[model samples]
Target: MLKWIAVAAGVLLLAAGMVPLAIIWIESRQARQAGGMEPHVASAQPARRGAVVVYFSRSGNTALAARHIANRLDADLHALEVPEYALGLRGLAHSALDADARRNDPARLRGIRPRTLDLRPFDTVWLGSPVWFYSPAPPIWAFVEHNRFDGQRVVLFNTYNSNIGDDQIAAFKARVMARGAASFEHRALLRGRMTRQIGPDEMLRRIDADWLAGDAVRAPLTARTPAPAAP
Candidate 1:
């Protein structure tokens, strides 16, 4: 069941089959949230065999959170890189188009494809990406398409500037659930145009399982951020 769901999640992200961005943009978010475990430091010991972090960051916010999580958990990390686009809005735009195109033509997707990430080797995969148009970034969609996640714990981390990330997280949950992951959880780190507060540990602690059940992460923390439009 999980094998099929994991493959489907990645495949769906990889293919649109003539679907447009609006529709894809509209029906966003998936994957249920995992609850119950306290955000304790991953003891100096290694996690289950396949403990790792695979992420895509356009604005660096997601990257920051990914690295922090990796450090706290002492997990292997893999960053999704696209050679052409550097980062920021331009990268976000490119990612948006890339996902749209892939939705239409799965084969059109390109760029470094790893022989394998070996999910079989890890017990959990902390997947990260920046939210775009209320959905996930293209490279992550591509990552999902390329890798196989069987019986592994699949957790999602996202960074967003536009909206608070409710829709985006929801969509991610749906996608992962379809993949039949061993378990899944989604958390959005507030950054970029969004006012970021709370330490990594606190953020992890705040990510209670109940919040995963619904879009109730936190109320807006309106701190004066650097130059940028509202999200």
Candidate 2:
């Protein structure tokens, strides 16, 4: 009777082990019967920069600054470019100079776009340009003029050969703000001569003081929340 009891105990242990195996097998079968599952694959869109680097680079200086700022901001970046076939660098120089001649001119680049840059999602718009004559490049001017800022923040990144200061920047700031941009900050980078040099860090340092450090402010067209209904 003792030996029979021992054998019964062994049978119970075997049954207990089998129960878990049975459960696993049953779950596998149920999963298969339901249907084989496939993993989801996501489609990609164009890279969106939290800070859109909108720039007009005639000699690549402004574009370079735009890239530097994008890197410093730890932001994604994009460049809207003109075809080299349409205008070589030399041609671009002449056009930029002529554009300076028409300083007051506000013509958009003919057929130049992703028509409207979708700056709506981004709170910060990093506006970059090579200062042409006494103001920002014409394309840069046109870009600021055409876009409706509504409630967005604007930061100006400007590069020049030599001889520019608050007069130019203040005017540029006024022009952009007039377009309804909520606010702006100015950064200057010197190009073309070794007489003055502003490395990327210095440009970014100034930009941070003016915009990103969060001092300058603008009034919102609408309150952050709708004002309580006036009785």
Candidate 3:
């Protein structure tokens, strides 16, 4: 009886370990199929002549999306670095705690100083961040808080593991607009366990079709009204 119980326990543990591996394999195969089936197209013209993509990516997933956006828009790319919080397991734990704090008390959140990049020449800025705890990563908030976007177009992008609720989007947008962004747009990619989430090709399509096409931009510029003729 003792032997049977030990065997059962071992089998259960092995199966548990194999579950994640199997899921990964299946997702990888699906990703390959999606990649093969998707066709590439020329990137659309930028909304403005000068543009830049600034992003913070810990797992490289957000970086991939930022690269695609920058390439499609023919813009410069910049990565935000947080060396102290990007090292290993301890770093990851620190990041999670920071994210939680930011979510709860955004005004009090600090640290994560992004490298300074000149934004004066750029009229359009693409900001990207990985979703942490249903909020934009703390590094992203730090970068945005330190920058000025007055009279500039700001487009936001977020990559998530599974879910990205509307409330998170609203919160992020409100924060950016408060910084004096003239216009705002956003796109999100779902990177869940199943592999059909927006890959490179899909991301390009979304950028061209939804973002570059101006569908995502909120509050279009209103034309100046002609003054009534003096009577």
Candidate 4:
């Protein structure tokens, strides 16, 4: 009797593991059929005061947000393609493990398109990524770690199904600001539960100027002139 119970528990565990794999397979297949993850740039328009959108998307959720942002800002768009996070069980496992390990090493990001970008020309820059492990994905961290945004307004956006803690947000904001960004702001889209989540259209609708431009954190004033010896 004990042997039978043990066998049943083992079978149940195996089934549980397969369920997620199957779901990942179906979603990955659907995404591929729907024209795999691609960096989308809006119709060519004059960059809004020299703006650009750079983003890292794993399963296209963040890509959608990036596309809308580029359109809203009339800016050029670029996607960071982390080969290590390509669609598949292996890739999914890699992403989760890396994030779980909190590995923000820039070397983990490779083979991304437009290998080098000059951020100096852009007065405003938008960065987007999906929330992984309740934080911005490691590739986003890798990008920020490798680059600086001197004197430019930097905006960070995220698409998350679950909650993003304030601690993570604070840390990421501090890191971006450390890169010499003139200002920083963060925006997030919460899709809620899978059964009642907002669709892509609604998500896009929410990406307006008010949503993007709100809650800005400007760099602290430096070298404030002293009063004339208090008169």
Candidate 5:
């Protein structure tokens, strides 16, 4: 009887895992359909210590991190938006589908805010986003693709529940470098799962200790931390 119970448990676990995989496949097909997804353009300008922190957040983790960086650096802050990915389960489904779809086509972003990014003024650009489907969110990719980072330092940052794989990091780094960024670096923090989530104060403390040491490197941060699950 115990052996039979163990077999059933294993089958249940496998079924649970397959459910999401099936959902992802279905979402991918839908995303590929016409009127499924679209892209948007950002506005641009020039200006003259100058830095900017731009990010997109679904659960506010990345947004909080962005605010902390902006305050610490006295840099300008801009938020990216995707109306389709609003705050709910449906929104989350859309986000997951978009991330999955991006693995192939990398669709242009639609309904994202601040249509333009003026890289001329800022010497350093900090791009922040939450990791989705083990990758940088689609909006971030669209923003990066639409802009040129010539002669400026580009730093990528993320707030995640689990980990951003090395391959994703390497790919993002290559993309930024290809865009003519003078330099590139990354920083990330693990906030744990939603139940035992890390608070804003503690998260900032980790950021200070790990990334924002002083005026010297006053630039960027993102990485992987062992955690219960994903965000």
Candidate 6:
């Protein structure tokens, strides 16, 4: 009887372990298949003005959105890098722990290298990050803390797996606004199974519509230029 009980316990543990692995496999397979699609290219001409996209992506979901936005606007793109972590699931877990520590104790967070960014030329800045435990990723905090956005229009974009990302977006907005950014706006994308439910083109259309509408708070009259006529 004891032997049978032990066998049953072992089987349950094995099944528990296999569940997460199966989920990971399915998500990865779907991502690879979706990767073959040619991303929608924005036909509209880029704004004839200074704009830039800066982002940190872990699973590449945020990177895809960043690329789409940058391509649509024809803006300069910058990818934030950290030396401590590698890419993939292991790196994601490592970064999440790091972000949690930073949230609890801000002083524990370290600054990123390759620190030089000249924000002077750009009037508009698009900041992107993947959500980490209801907070912006650690690298994002490092970058935003070290930079000044005075007199700039700042837009926040985030990618998340399950959560709606309200807390993450709010936290990010408060930080950048405190740094003297002139205006703040945001957009969030749901990834994984949620994305598969909505379809990729729907996501693209939402992003494009938000961009065309200038969804953020109004920029100062001087900073606002009329968008170029669509070709």
Stretches of model 1 off by over 4 angstroms after superposition: 1-50, 88-93, 99-115, 164-171, 178-180, 192-231
The TM-score of candidate 5 is 0.72
Cα lDDT computed for each candidate against the true fold: 0.57, 0.57, 0.69, 0.72, 0.74, 0.69
TM-score of 3: 0.66
Poorest 10 consecutive residues by lDDT, candidate 6:
215-224
**Candidate 3 — what's its lDDT?**
0.69
CA lDDT of 196 in candidate 2? 47
Error of 2 at 228 (Å): 51
For model 6, what is the error of residue 28's alpha carbon versus the real structure, in angstroms, after optimal superposition?
Answer: 5.0
Q: Which of the predicted structures, 2 or 4, would earn the higher TM-score when compared with the native?
A: 4
| Shift of residue 168 alpha carbon in model 4, Å | 1.3
Tens-digit per-residue lDDT, 39-83, candidate 1: 223324554444687886544445655655665455677777786
Give each model's clash number: 18, 0, 0, 0, 12, 0
- State every prediction's TM-score relative to the real structure: 0.56, 0.56, 0.66, 0.78, 0.72, 0.73
Q: List the residue pairs that clash in candidate 3.
A: none
Better structure of 4 and 6 per TM-score: 4
Candidate that would win on TM-score: 4
Worst-scoring 10-residue span by lDDT in model 1: 27-36
Which residue pairs show backbone clashes in model 4? none
Please, what are the lDDT tens digits per residue for candidate 5 over residues 1-231? 999999999999999877756544533433343122111112122233478889987666677677777766667788898888876557767888888888776564555776668867888999999898788898888788878899998889998877787888888888888999999989988878644667666887897788778444333323323346766
lDDT of 4 at 38: 29
Residues 1-231, model 4: lDDT tens digits:
999999999999999999758747654654553343224535344543477889987766678777767755557788898787888887888888888777455345434454567888788888898887788888787788778899998888898878887778888888889999989888888976534667666776676544655423222113234447754
Q: Which segments of candidate 5 are over 4 A away from where they belong? A: 1-49, 107-111, 214-231
Which candidate comes out best when scored by lDDT? Answer: 5
lDDT of 4: 0.72
